[model samples]
Target: MLIKTFENKRIGIDELTGQVISGVTFLNCDFSKVDLSETEFVDCIFYDSDRQLGCNFRSAKMKGASFKRCDLSVCAFNFVSALGLEISECKAQGADFSSASFMNVISHKSWFCSAYINKSNLAYTNFSKVNLERCELWDNRWTGANVTGASFSGSDLSGGEFNSFDWQSADFTGCDLTDSELGDLDIRTVNLEGVKVSRDQMSELASRLGINVLG
Candidate 1:
């Protein structure tokens, strides 16, 4: 399906059910308020040439798709599945990835500032050097994910799964960890200065640091 043929057109949810749309470059298309649930996009590229409006992926399922330099601000991606997804230098501010599942995906130099990523499964996903300031990431499962040089400053990481992880060169400055699960993590490795946490969390971290919190 050539997307240019559907230029200045609106593709709603009903028209995108389980359809295999490949090699279709969506340029200057508006996908706002569309429920593209369980849709398959292989080798497809989507971007807004205007750079003003963003294509909405509100509850859409994507596979083997790539996006370059697109704006995905404030879009909903609840319960979406994207395996081997590739995104580069895109603006995803305030986008909801709640309960979304991703695997073997590579996202480089993207801006996810203040994006909601709660209860999501991100196993073996590469998120190198992404800007994730003040993102809500509660109760998310992250296994075997590479976060080298990724910044999560001022983000909420409460009750999130953080097991068997490598956090080399990762920044967690001023993040909130209220009722969050942070076990098997060495406090001396990553940066956590001025990070907000409960009193119990402090005691646990202090013990790990070999400092007895007697109180």
Candidate 2:
């Protein structure tokens, strides 16, 4: 069956759970407050090149929603309840995720975040002040992405490309950073306590601090 296509329209569907939507085009559509739990969107286009805009997903309930090989560039995901959201091999550059919560709260002080955003392009995306602890965020491009005050503690960030990224602005303690490109990541300045890195990466980081590893 062919996938449905939507363009420049306001989507009124409230529930789209457990559906496989492939090769769909949602140009400048409004999906605010829509429940998309466990929905799989493959090879979809959410960005509009002519209008230079993307689909709006503000306040959307997106638990366990999977987006693979999709174009979600410049999309707005503000205030989204996105627990267990998985986005793989997607172009999500300049997307706004500021206020998006991937947490499942048990109490006021007890909460956990779950999301897998791997092998994607997240360059120039906004993730300021977001708490993404213990999430799977590996092998993504994060160049010029805004992560100020964001906590990525205990997350897997292996094989990521972080050119022009400010590591000091975010908390990456206890993160797995093996085989990732660590651009301008100063070990003397950034707190990497319990963060995993390869021996070659450690030597490279130490060399940046003017330390000679003769071994």
Candidate 3:
């Protein structure tokens, strides 16, 4: 816990529990509502930080950081690497990224509920309107990702690798794409009601469920 660059520094409600902040460098820092529960930030560097409303980056590394509007709830980024991060509208609940390595990250409208991202490596991420309820993204890759209106309720994307993604209005209810790879992608107005798709993803969504494939 060695904070440098002490300008406009306001480490609010500091509790720094179980602290182990290595090589700290927080320029323009303002850790608002900071509890930092079970904190352990190795190789820490948070430039222009602004975390408010019950902040706790539990088991944090936050590699290559740039966080904005942070409100990391029940945060326990298990095995956290957080590669190339840039978070916005953050309110990550029960956050426990099982095997975390979010490469090229860019989170917008974030609120990862019940998060426990299993075997994670969300490649080229750009999660818009993110709200992964009951999340446990198994074997996640999400190549070239741009998950629009993301909301995978009861998520457990088994053996995941959704390549070339642009999942429009995404909402995979009760999600569990076993051995996942929703190929030939163009899920228009995406809202697979009670989603648990298999059988070759219902013959690749039967020609966009009979026309109107995003017009």
Candidate 4:
């Protein structure tokens, strides 16, 4: 299949499944509602695209790219490298990002329900209003990441670092935080009413609750 460069093109509802777009660049293209399932994008770049719904970028490189408002649901991004990328308002439910690296990425309002993102680097990322229900985030680094209004219901966040980040209004309902680092963090507005906490974490929460602990 001959790979084409749709740079600055306005294409909608196109089917680009099972195609090999290695080293292709789509600069400022409009691929709204395009079905790109099982497509391989090695070293591809997508700059300033408006992809609204039902677009698949399964198992793609996606490094150094900027995707805005792209609907990347059910996409398999296993072993994909999405370093230095900026994605906003993207719906990526059921996306497989297992063993993927998201270094220095800024994403907001992205939905990642049931996504496999084990051992991913989510440091300094803004995940406000993102839904990460039932996602695998074990051993991930979330240092200085903002998770305001994000939902992690039924997700595994064990051994992850949440250093000095604001988790206000973030839902961790029924999620495991065992061996997770949450020390000296400001979680004032986050709802931890019925969430499970370790003994050390309980002490920390008790300290925040103004319980006088006399040494």
What stretches of model 1 exceed 4 Å from their correct place?
Answer: 1-112
- TM-score of model 2 relative to the true fold? 0.96
Candidate 1 structure, TM-score to reference: 0.49
Query: What lDDT tens digits, residue by residue, belong to model 4 across residues 91-168?
Result: 444334454445433577453343444444566555565566666666666776656667778777787788765666
- Candidate 1 accuracy as lDDT: 0.58
Candidate 2 lDDT over 1-215, as tens digits, reads: 67777887876665466788889899899999888888899999999989999999999889999999999999999999999999999999999999899999999999999999999999999999899999999999999999999999999999999999999999999999999999999887899999999989988988887887766
Runs in model 3 lying further than 4 Å from the true structure: 1-7, 10-204, 207-215
Give model 4's TM-score versus the native structure: 0.48
Residue-wise C-alpha lDDT for candidate 1, range 85-158, written one tens digit per residue: 44434445444555455533347744334345554455544555555666666666556555676777887877
Ranking by lDDT: 2, 1, 4, 3
Q: Which of 1 and 4 is the better model by lDDT?
A: 1
TM-score of 3: 0.27
Clashing pairs in 3: none
The local lDDT score (0 to 100) that residue 107 gets in candidate 4 is 70
Q: TM-score: which is higher, 2 or 3?
A: 2
In order, the Cα lDDT scores of the candidates are: 0.58, 0.94, 0.53, 0.55
Pairs clashing in candidate 1? 159-180
Worst 10 residues of 3 by lDDT: 47-56
Candidate 3 residue-wise lDDT at 36: 50
Candidate whose TM-score is highest: 2
